[model samples]
Target: MFFDILPRVGLKPKDYILKFILPASVISLLLLILGITYFSGYTRLVVLFLPLLLMGSAIGYPYIELDSQRQKINERLHIFITKFGVLSITDLDRKELMHLLATEKEELGQLATESHKIFVLIKRWNQSLAESCRFLANRSPSSQFGDFLDRMAYSIDSGQELKEFLHGEQDIVMEDYGEFYKRAIYTLDTFKEMYVSAVTSVSFFVTFAIIAPFLLPYDFVTMVTVALLGFVLIEVLLVYAIKSRLPYDRLWHTGEKPTKIDLKLKKWLIISVIGTVLFTLFLLWGKFIGEIPQIMKIPYQIIFALGMSPLAIGGYFAQREENLVIRKEFNFPDFLRSLGDSVSAKGGGMTDSLEYLSSNDFGPLTKDLEGLYKRVSIRVNSQKAWRYFGYDTCSYMIQLFSEMFERCTFLGGNAGVAAHMIGKNFRKIINLRKAKYQSVSQFSGIMYGLAGGMALTLYASAGVANMVNGLYTSLDIPDTMISIVNIITPEDFSLIAYLIYGVLVIYSIVSGYLIKLMDGGHYQVSLMHFVIMLWVASIVGYIAEVMTGSLLGTSLPI
Candidate 1:
């Protein structure tokens, strides 16, 4: 509808009008009506933020996409440069070169896709290489990529040696990428401090919100909803932080899939689902049945934690698998260099070289190498065997380099030089990932500390409120002696405790996943952290409740 009306509107900033203004105006109108009639309290508060959230999302979407693509291209820039340089040194004709670019699996996805488009334009439309590159440069999603393409177009137009240009440009690009990486790391450090400060402030706000009702008498439901909105906002910010820093690499697998470990993990995944469902049903039954008040007394957050436990356990195994792949990558470059040397020593025969290298320890990758060698020894097709090895490792780095090695050797190129290139490139990526993880490590600790503090504050607030209210009851004070205030009654205390638990659970889940995201893009890696944080929050909240209750002569209902 907005697209149709956009021309009639004649908005000066058309992008804003088409994307943000129209959609936000519509949502705001709908939300206002709903807030005025059906929604009350916390729901109304959440409704009020919907239009702002929509506007922000519309404005930020393109920037986020561009930033994400930039990081991805940066991650694979070295690989692209190395592969293109190696291929350039080959004697392949232009057609074959274009074919190679279209088919190459090791190159960055954005670069490969754009190269394929340029290749199509040149082949189908008979456009010159320079023209095709210029077309792509203008349309490139990432600014860095556009700059590279522009440089390539200029070089081609000037009739420069493409190989020499690429070789020189590679260093310059790498230097730029290195600086970008350092800046991203710095941004993450800033995010960490901001996370700590925001969380501390949020905790204080929630505490004050919970306790202030005794004096101010705000709607209880609105307070809870406001707290949830705050949490959602924090989560959104964390997601942005993670996306900004995450490397844009696609995970791929080749050949027949599902190793023994894969099968085992699948079963565990099912078990996790079943366990979560059964526990959740049990909790729901207890809550509704009224027969088991004790079950209801068990904090809902604790129930949620219990229900998610199986998934967390399963996630530990998944995380272990991911880590194993990473560890293999750490040793992969050395293995490639060794294989290259051995192959060169054996007159470029890969079979004997693999046999020779299988005896050598290549760390976590040794087992896979041994398997590859054995398969080849048994007269298995070499490509098939290598693909199997790559798939079995379940590492994106392994898959990429394996394909690169296959391409180099298939073209009768110098395998030793190829090995050296792959090794250095892979090492660079590994080091960057390590640095990224290290940057967030301290912030992760701070998150835990904040969770603990939040729990303590909630506990103290509830306890103190109960203690004061109890004295009011014990004194048998006249109605005239007390001002009109919202008393923290038993029911109110129960509800407030539940709200605190809900917020704490949210905080734990968000912080845990954000930390994992900053460390790596793997969702599985975040599970153990989520489980740990949940436990910390629950334990701390429970402990504080018990201690404060004992001191204040008032016990939590649970």
Candidate 2:
């Protein structure tokens, strides 16, 4: 299987062996020699693993590359097909359609690359379209795309109309895409379970580490650090896994011009930065410089929460913009359908059609639609006008499909048919995103609950350990008993408390990022989840410490 994938990925077997495999083998041998000669004990053992890991990665590089190519191709294959179908209904001939699809590299990525290869075969090699399609199908990495090419090859050979073939393939292709989407969601669910189990186990281990130091001769700081690193590694791996498994979809448009929401986000971000700095300075002063009044004396957990509160402003705006984008995307298909019908009815003037449609309510999309009409009415460059419209709406799907609609209608395609096709696929994609959003919502709730639970357990353990230490210190015990008891000092408990706080902060950041990855939102939006998780951990941790102190009649000095 590895060898077969080489040619498909444009790698020759001889070149692979000489250029990659042989060099990696030599490097591994050198590393093994150095490890045995220079390293000792466990250090040598750790070094020895590097050679094995490197060789294994080198050997598997081809398979990894093949899988990556397949993912890139399959990522946008459904959209590529939908756009291709829309173009097929236009007056474009086979060659022109292939050329146009090949040029859409920005939108279609590897699918467009494959289309360009097919175009090269047809144009340069003078092969028939069916022959080229069949040739590419045989070597395509993605089974779904390959099957599509194979069927398209047969249809072209049998004198079927391209538009008719695509119309028939839509349901079949969409079903496959839906299945692919669901499988990804299931993968995320599995990873979510793994994350919860792994992180919970790590938290318990860290708690054990904190408590065990009081009973055993262990370095409290070193044990906690090791456990924290393990926790971090687990979260990082889960994040990467989730990111790879999720489908590629962007919530925001990537136009060159910044939209009004973008400007608002920028302004709020600056304000957030200034607020963070001022709040942090105030906390520092209260901690080290100023006298704390009775009312101002609060737990450090609450102080940390207060320091991060300013970031909520930026997060709020970002989330609001994302919501607006979703609403615009939802309303876009209806607006497109109406505009298409109007264009056909009025004999094909887009500006007039848009003008008529702009007066109708399209939820968040109405203002953007009106702007598009105004631009077009003033004889703005049609492409630029539509592009600006996409930027204003801030919806990736709307931008892509709107471009398709405009291009097809300009080329004399049936606007109604084109709009219907684009809208159908657009709606399907929206439904998939909604399903993903629901899953992420459930995952977010689980993460928040886990954060609170973890904070309670971790801080309660620390509090109990502190109380035990205090008890040992207060009681008049003999030197022999003192030597046997091995009670941790107040200073040690203080350090452990800070370590627990560190763990909570790290957990909050990682869990927030995981949620953002699943939902395909901006990273700034993760700040919202981050702040909430932090607050949850803080409140739970404070309650646990207070409860433990009241029950045990001792507490760590803050």
Candidate 3:
């Protein structure tokens, strides 16, 4: 039904503001105004709900569009560079090679679309290759690709060999790619610093907001709502800002068989589920039925901490999987170097070279290497077999390197040369990744500390509010002073505690995901970090509650 209406309003996927955000804003504003006018005393409820509607409209769809665009450009650009480099060195003719490049069915995102346009202009409209390339260059979305096209057009006009130009251009592209890789790492380092500063500052603000009810005559619920919204907004925007700078490539691979690790994770998962359920039941019974003793009563913060334990356990397993993959990748260049040495010495093909190399230890990759040797030795569709070999490795750099090697070898080119090039490029990338991870390691401590601080401050603020409210009600104040008192009762403090607790839950998750994304180049590996951060929030909240109660017992009238 929404889709049916979307077209009527000139909405499309690319026009994010018109397609999603503008309509969301219009509807939210209308609903907000209606609630304010029709309902007498629910302004706080309406205001509290507005953040989700407004923030999603303003930031959500735009970020989605940007992420989509980044993926398309990255994939397309990589494919073009890899393919152009390999085909240039092959014996395929200029026109035949250009035809293959232009008409290849492999989707290089916008690159494919533009290349197809160039092909159509030349073959259908009878435009020369130079003319078609010139036209395409003028309209290309990526400026770097445009410059490449413009150079290609010039090369054609001057009667220079397209192969030579492409071969030379690969060196330039690789250099640019190295710089690009470095810039992304630098951006991540900068983002980490910004994140620490932003989260710490927001933590202090939330603390102040929580304490405001004691001193200021404002709606306590409204103040909590604003604090929650403010924290959520900063975290969400920070995540959005970094999405564009992260790598977008992913590897495809053969199915992975379950191992001992899977079995261990499964057992822990069951235990976590049962433990969480039991904890929740205990909390409910204490809250609703009053069956538990006062000393045994579990706070909501403690309950939240216990519930997220399973995710942490599961995340550890995920981190292990990533670690194994990285270990395999770390030795990949050595494997490539060995392959090149074997091929150069024995004058054998990739299959024979791999059969000998499989006997050597490639660290974590030894098992996969044996599998690849069996497949290729059996002559079971070499290209498909090598592709799965790349996929099984599950490293983006390996995928790219393997594709280049596969292309060159399939073209009956020098396997030794291809291996050397792949090894060199892979080594450079690996070193950059190590440096990036090392640079970002210091920020992890900052995150853990800041997350705890935020949680503690929030919990302490709630404790103070409750303590002050209790004293205000019990005291024999003047009638005039009683009218001026702005007290948050114990019941109201419970609501605020739960609300702020929920906000902290989200902030911790987002921050953990951000840390993982910056370090691992993906967020799927963030579960461990997320779980740890949640535990930090939970523990800090409890500690703050205990300390606040003890301190106030001496300082305030009981």
Candidate 4:
């Protein structure tokens, strides 16, 4: 029954139940009790107006969180695919990875609990794909890792062939995975840096979003619409500016890390700060440097605020610098090339040579790697340990290296050559990335522009709506203009009035998906699109108030 009303009402039955029906019903009952009071009616004030506003906000917050995560993921996917060459490892692979991950959960759990293998497997299986391995590896090989590899090894051609192939493919697989890892790392670098920038952007709104709205108690729809629109537009341009300021992608597999990020962050910070100071000084300098406003300067103030806001956010990110979480992930390919050499050397156990990397000099990943190394050194096995390392490290570099180490230890023949080949593959992957970035950067501006600019339009239109209210008074229009203004509207100033809402609605929906479709995936953007549209509607409505007064020539009433 509710489904039938969904399209016409622009809401689902369930939503309408919460948004329109439930509260409206409650308010309707209250209104029936209160009756229309003299002077400002309490029904409109306490019953109708406030409840709808609160309902809208409650429904909207979840949508925001959902969209925020969706946006983050889509963006991550875009950078990941573009910066690294295409690589597919789906949640579908979870089953396969899980089987390997739980190779010996029972044995490990027995030291802790005897009757829990199935439960442990299920628990580990449900964890994030990367996390599943982290959980297992942090626990160490015990017997689980070798058991998983033994399972992986068995899957090769046939059981005997699987064993033989595992021995042979160890170096080759490690090298290939290493190459894949490099491309992954290159992409992650940009993502991590941008993520920090994005977080800072979120922070700028953090204070405003929580407190200012409540204290001001101004027309919410008007301000929120403007804020959202401006946010979108500024973000679009700023993202463009940030993208522009970012150096071109360069393939660097074995050389020192990209120094440009450090240099450019500093450079842009200095430039933005200097520009802000000069502009502030110029404004405060008054007629000394420019035209002194003897008239309305509010518009100029608005423009200045809009223009300066993004830079403050940009400057925030330029200050935080995080080195690679997994530097060895990059170095692993090169190390694998050496491993192939070590394997061919015909000397001691392949296990001993591989454990050398888990050292202190590197960052967080090195510690994890050292733990994996420690497992093999102490227990003479690393299957579960390797899997742990593979999944836990978020960086593609670490996962690949962990996988490679497992393979080489099993297939000791080309450990050294495998290492060399892995490095070479990283070089190839890096080259491909350079090509991808150049092609992709072409649209970076367009996406950001569309996103940011459209958002700003949402903001500006509300103010325009507000401005419209005075037109009637200016024109000396009659009180009957609401009925007589058929040329401009059917119900009210309805023509261009609802036009902005339509635009903001479509813009929110399309942008949410466009961000996902063009780049990649988002968890659930639909809900967010709805929230954004609702917020925008409120903004445009506020503008409508001003516009209403202007159009009708209504004087400001006490």
Best by TM-score: 2
Task: List ranges where model 1 is wrong by over 4 Å.
Answer: 1-72, 103-107, 134-143, 150-161, 167-169, 249-256, 270-312, 377-381, 475-483
Predicted candidate 3 versus true structure: per-residue lDDT over 454-490, tens digit per residue: 8887777777777777788788888888657887655
lDDT of all predictions = 0.73, 0.86, 0.70, 0.41
Q: What's model 2's overall lDDT?
A: 0.86
> Judged by TM-score relative to the true structure, which candidate is superior, 1 or 2?
2
lDDT of 3 at 362: 86
RMSD for each of the candidates: 5.6, 1.8, 6.4, 16.1
* Candidate achieving the largest lDDT: 2
Q: For candidate 1, what is the total of clashing residue pairs? A: 0
Per-prediction TM-score:
0.80, 0.96, 0.78, 0.35
312: Cα error in model 4, Å? 13
* Clash number for each model: 0, 0, 0, 48
Prediction 2 TM-score vs. true: 0.96
lDDT (10s digit) by residue, model 2, range 232-321: 888888788778777887787888878888888989988987998899779867776785564257788988888988988898899998
List, residue by residue over 1-558, the lDDT tens digit for candidate 1: 334323222223567566677887788788878877898889988987786787777666555666555566676676677777666655675556766787764455656766677788888998887888888777665677779889988998898987678757756776667776777788778777777777777777777776666567576546755875786688678678667665654332433567766777777777777887897788878876754888877765577777777778667787777778778888888999988888877888888889888898888899999999898888747677777888778776687677778777877777887777667767877787787767777777887778888888878877777777676667766777566645555776687777778778777778777876776545665667777788778878878888998887787654
Q: Residue 221 in candidate 2 has what lDDT?
A: 72
lDDT, residue 495, model 4? 31
What is the overall TM-score of model 1 with all chains considered together? 0.80
Error of 1 at 339 (Å): 1.5
